[model samples]
Target chain A: MTRDRIGALFFLAVSIAYGLMSLDIRVPPFASEGFTARSLPLALSAAGTLIAFLMLVLPQKDGPGVEPAGRFLAGLGGFDWPRIAGLALNMLAYGFLLTRVGFLVSTILFLIVGYRLLGERRWHVLLLASVPVVVVFWAILTQLLDIFLGSALGRWGQLLAAQFSGGA
Target chain B: MLDGILTGLSTALTPTNLAMVFIGCFAGTFIGMLPGLGPISAIALMIPITYGFDPATGMILMAGVYYGAIFGGSTSSILINAPGVAGTVATSFDGYPMARKGLAGKALAIAAYASFSGGTIAAIFLLIAAPALASVALSFQSPDYFALMVLGLTAVSAFAGRGNFLKAMMMTVVGLMLAMIGSDPVVGMPRLNFGRVDLLDGISFLLLAMATFALSEALMTVLKREKISDAARAATQGRMGSLKLSGAEVKEMAPVVARSSVLGFFIGVLPGAGATIASFLAYGMERNFARGAKKEEFGKGSIRGLAAPETANNAAASGSFVPLLTLGIPGSGTTAVMLGALISYGVDPGPTLFTERPEVFWSVILSMYFGNVILLILNLPLIPYIARLLTLPSNLLVPLVLFFSLIGVYLVSFNNFDIYMMVIVAVVAVMLRLFDYPMAPMILGFILGDLMERNLRRSITLNDGSISFLWERPITLTILVITAVIVALPLVGFFRQRRRLAQAGEGG
Candidate 1:
């Protein structure tokens, strides 16, 4: 299938799934609103399904910048998928580490890994960019803005300190 | 009205607000100059920072960013022939040529002056039109609001350009579906969460905006392996000849600027039509209006060519604010982001904004005047310096952008789920974008979905569960009729064109 046709099929499946799921929305007994929560979702699913169905059945029309006969696999193949995947992994890792480590440590590590993944080789450039940014951002959040940034580890530390001081 | 203006003037002139205008513009320019990062991304990045600010100050800052981003986009277009924003694509046609002719400084100057003129003229029009529209909108009931939202969404799809109607419509429907994911607006009952505590609150607009525009855009840049060419770097560092415009050049651009400013403002007021369209239209209009050698000079370094789009786009930027401020309907993606920010600030934008918090309404308008002036005075000289940002390697830039987008959302809720959810959404957005689907309509649909549903539910309730309210009131009927016409006209044109082609093929 062409790229758009493939997209259409995906959307068609999504619309059907969403439509089925809309049936599960439970309305409370005392909620007397005329339009229930499922009303718009159900309507949107029907509209989505119809549109996707039309897109699938209709003759494939190419928009500007899109070639009519471009294959889905061909379009996806040219992209630098490995690099993108690396970045995604990095982001996911950052998210996992953010709470495990404190904000300062997590953010610095995130920036350094990000820079390295993107092809930065110089140690000075990486450290200068990541460390100062983390420090400044940390100061701004904690000191300047007075907004507290906490981590799981920090909470654990606080708990330990409270217990050591003989407080519950 | 005079009192409102005075209130706006007082708020806008405050030292803190003045500094905000400068800071917003500078930051916006820096960010917008980056390839793949437009005004939407720039403003989305600023949302977390503006969380603690007063509504007027936040808006003033955002408005400045909006104008600055457009200006910054024009700079990249002129210098590198790579339009940083879609709206500046037309600008690169003549602008890059002029820059190649060793008039980069002059081109930048003309763009600044034209943007200033366009923005100022539109601000004046805004000053007049906004109050009138707000008063008219005061009488808007649920049905009228529902119809207006329909008109807005329909117009967005209708104007999604040739071959994109179905795609835009589908994306819009997807947005509506996404909007229904969290808790139901009316009853606060969970619908599509599938029993997750995080899903009960639904999706955060900030997270969605950050994921789709900021993170996805950054990832796309990396995925495409886009980098600033050495030629672009040299152009930035090279000596730009002359920033002064001759008298004849000024006279030539005056009429074009005036005409494009008007065209741009009106087009901007229309739902779905925005700076990109306004710029293209203005460029086309000026080409048609020119005579003899001047007409042929277009796309070959004609002053009028560069000035027309530069002016129209800025005017259109201001023009877009009309729908957002007066009707609470965002006319374009950039304004949709702003509308989300306004809602987050606990200041519902619409008719009541003018009466309830005139400072926010007027100060934003007044700030435009200052924003335009700042672009002319501040950015005109700083172009050479700001243009250097173009040379910043994407390797470093993209990662920083990714970090900011992830951290921006994480800072808001301090929730790890948002980060993971954002990455997932960004990946999906990237996939959808790869298939030639426009993301703007999706964002627009998502932003308007809740409001549209609420109005729709209210209309149905008030009319005793009948949807007759769609045509009952005059305003509602008129808006719906207009929407119908907008959708029909494009499809009619498409079918007619296809038929003509078929007949020709048969005859042949």
Candidate 2:
């Protein structure tokens, strides 16, 4: 009915699923005599399940809770669902676009969108701020550290190669 | 011992190592001064950069960040009444009042000097103590090591924040489960990879650390919209007069600093007791020790009130390294991340580290000395400028941090999938944190899980699969007993609280 109860139920469901999955682990024949792969997992699952069960039975001391089951569904209305969902979608899009669009482009786009969502209204500030951050981080990561940033740069390299070959 | 110190000095005093130390300290201080960043995030964000370095250099850099952040945290506490890190929370008690009284510069100066004194004193202790402790740990067998890990795991429950024992334990279990993913530690067989090639190495420690500390923090910042605009505005308004402590004031605070430094170091050496506890303990002890008008002056900007916690917390930050370096058991989340960094650098930290890699040991220790000097000299004059950074808009800060996290995660594994997985992990971590679940135990559990399992299995094998090996050895038995006591003591407190609540309910 409360957040605590919802958390308990979630943990309980996860423990059960994890316990079931761990049961399918097959120990290799050459493994030495002792605890195998499933040992800690099974133990963890059991401990988690037990704790979750206790959480359900024992009322939390600090807050007001122990309401009806209908309140569990009602609690969704209490949260800032739209904002949270928007943030989640923003992150998902950023991650999805990262490799496709490349580091510099995706990062700048993500920052602009993220800053807006966080209530920064001035478009000029967002545009001015995002470019320097993207450039600086790009220089640091790719040029300084020599980490291979993906996609857009790689595409540029391909185009250069094609043009040089064609010219030859 | 003298030779080791000399050798450490030789290693750490090199120009590159010295530069790394300065960079680490400066970045640590700068980042830790930001609201909601803290020492853990500072350390976590720096790990990717350290991959380019050797083991000793990486460790020296990390060690610099560790204590530098502690020093930096007091700046925010004093200036903005927002403790940049949890350890500095006690500093705000008297610090903000001191600032309100127009003694901001004096309070900042005292805090810097006190921090220097505490850190220097504790480094002296660490120099003597860590090697001796490592020598003692050298004789530890597999079972004893197993018991020690268990003790470390159990001790988390003791300090796992207010009354969430079961939740903390659940988090520990979950962390262990997460650690069990990827390949099997003992047999070299795939266990929980679920047929994904990317999961073969399991989850990257860098990714886990970033997601748990950095990404989750960004999400929470977004949700809360906690702005430092006011603190920033106020920080720029006035002249911070006289960044110097008077002679009499220095003389008065010296003994208090020394006493709290010693008390804080021992507290820091104990597993799971960190800077926050040390600072609060020192503050409380000082309050109790004060008499007459001085006692009443505590909350109203007493110099002793400001000095005690500042000194002790710095000392405790230095002391926390003792367990991590010697026993390979980290008492706090930041040190646990350090342990992960050490492991990533391919230097297994334990008793053998003293003999095998004395350079690593000594360089890190020597770097702390340099780091404290750097902080003392640099922190005073720069306090005004550093305080101004608190005014940086959250919109810019949050996105910048998120960009760092995303790129840092990708750089480590160079895999797009890891970035995707990191996002998922961050979401779960944010939810867990929202529910007041402590992430430290989970991080420690993940860091210690593999070693714990290996030692445990080896011990069992040596004992012919007999579980009694745990209790048969004196050291093992003693450690297990201590672990039992640590775990049980909290449950005792929990029940007592419940009983009190029940009694009050009945009376009402």
Candidate 3:
């Protein structure tokens, strides 16, 4: 169907779920005098449900600011989804690796991969762009700002040293 | 008031704060010159950097960035016919034409002068108007605050332009729903965290801002497969002539700048009506008021045409700060982001701010003057070198932007969960953007959501379960009544248009 229809259905589902969840919020006896914790969320859920329902049922207006109806699937097909998905995956991987490998290594890998995915394939360019930038950024954070960044390798080394000393 | 002004002058004139303004302006300009980025993104990017700064310095820096972004948007409008921000779209109508005539340098100079004058004039207005308004706002109660918040939210959707009212409202509700995620604010008990401890503290405003504005915007550039570097290279080819304006050209633009600045400032004072609307209105007004030949020259590189929007947009940017300072209410998305930043600094911006932190309140206002002078004197001569940054390839630039945005959020809490959550939010934001939904209303809703609920809860508690307080207080009732009118007027127009269309069809 159309994009607006898809949006309506999505919001409708969200509001219903939200309304159900708000019911699970526990209100203490002392705080339940007039307005409880669940009060605003419940109101918002009802409002969201009503608005979404109206959007689904009402005729979509044709004028400025409103795009003409197009098949939702077709509209989605035109986007460079592969590239976007790659970027999203890169971000996810960075997060996973950050604390595991440390900020410097994780960030450098993130930038190099991001550049490669976006069509920068030059080896020298990738190395030059990623390494120096990451080092400078890392130095700024650790040295200048005095923020601590944990290194997984350093932690492993410490653990090994602790085990040997205990055995001795 | 004199003492407050002197305090502001002393604080704003400090070495560190001046450096903040300079850095903020330079960074803002560079980012704003990039297509698809606006002041909202510019300000959002700076929030991480400002986290360590004192409140006054932080605000001064943000204010400078706000002006610089608008000014930088004008630069792209003139050189590349690409209005990086919506506020500068009208500037391209005449600005690009002037560039085409080999007068890029002259056009840049004119824009700088016009922006300077507009910003300076509006800063004066803010200096006079802010404290007076803050004093009056001191008497506001919880019920009145509740009403005012409702008014601000409704006004945003009302001005969401034709045919998008329901969509904007839906976005607002969604934002409100998002705000209720972490815990029950009043009870301090977890509500919607789904048993995840990471979400117990709730979604950070910085994460939300960066995800929606910065990350999503960069991803959108890649999604569209735009050859941004090619476009930038093409725009930077021509000679920038001389940065000089003849006396006749100055005379023609003088009245337009003055008129548009006043109009822009007033419009900017209204919630949801910011720089974009101000610039367009100013352009239209100048076109209508111009005499014969000058009127024909409108949109054909008329000096008045270029000056009107440039002046008005900067003035409007300054004017938007009024509500943020006086009422603790943000009139637009940029200010909404600023409000979140201010709250993170442990400074609640409201009427009491004037009495409690007069230095912060007045310094922010005073710094606008300094920002304007710096933009004109230092930045004007350096435009060509700055414009060269536009030639940076999208492949390199996009990755860096994404890195910065992701890293900025990650730096705050140092949580891996935040990064994953940000990616998810950015994806959702991209989807919503593709559906033609505006992100500003959602941000506005999110920023105002907690405060609105607090005021509402207090009002309800005070009234002993009676909801009549919504109409019982004169100020609160008046505010709500205005909200009703704002919501109704748009619906009324929609219906009338439908009826007219039906009548014509029947006649045919």
Best by DockQ: 3
The digit string of per-residue lDDT tens for model 3 on B400-419 reads 99889988888889889999
Backbone atom clashes (below 3 Å) for every candidate: 0, 0, 0
True-contact fraction per candidate equals 0.88, 0.51, 0.87
- Tens digit per residue, CA lDDT, model 1, A5-35: 8788899999999999998999998754567
Which candidate do you rate higher for lDDT, 1 or 2?
A: 1
Q: Candidate 3 versus the native: TM-score?
A: 0.97
Ranking by DockQ: 3, 1, 2
lDDT of 3 by residue, A61-99 (tens): 754223435545666789899999999999999998887
Can you tell me which runs of candidate 3 are displaced by over 4 Å? Answer: A31-33, A63-72, A152-168
Report the TM-score for the A-chain of model 1. Answer: 0.83
| Model 3 alpha-carbon miss at residue A130, Å | 1.0
Clashing pairs in 3: none
* Stretches of candidate 2 exceeding 4 Å from the true structure: A30-34, A63-84, A121-123, A155-168, B497-508
Candidate 2 lDDT by residue in tens digits, B1-508: 7887888899999998999888888888888888778888889998888898998899888888877788788888888888889999999999889888888899899899999999999999999999999999999999998899888877776776665777777777787888888887877788777889999898888899898888888777666667787876686577576787788999889989999999989989888889999999999999999999989999999999999999999899889999898988898888999999999999989888888888888889889989999888886788788778778888778878887887787877767787778778888887787667788888888998888888988898888878898778999999999999988887788789889989999999
TM-score of 1: 0.97
How well does each candidate superpose onto the true structure, as a TM-score? 0.97, 0.94, 0.97
Residue B102, model 3: Cα distance from true site in angstroms: 1.2
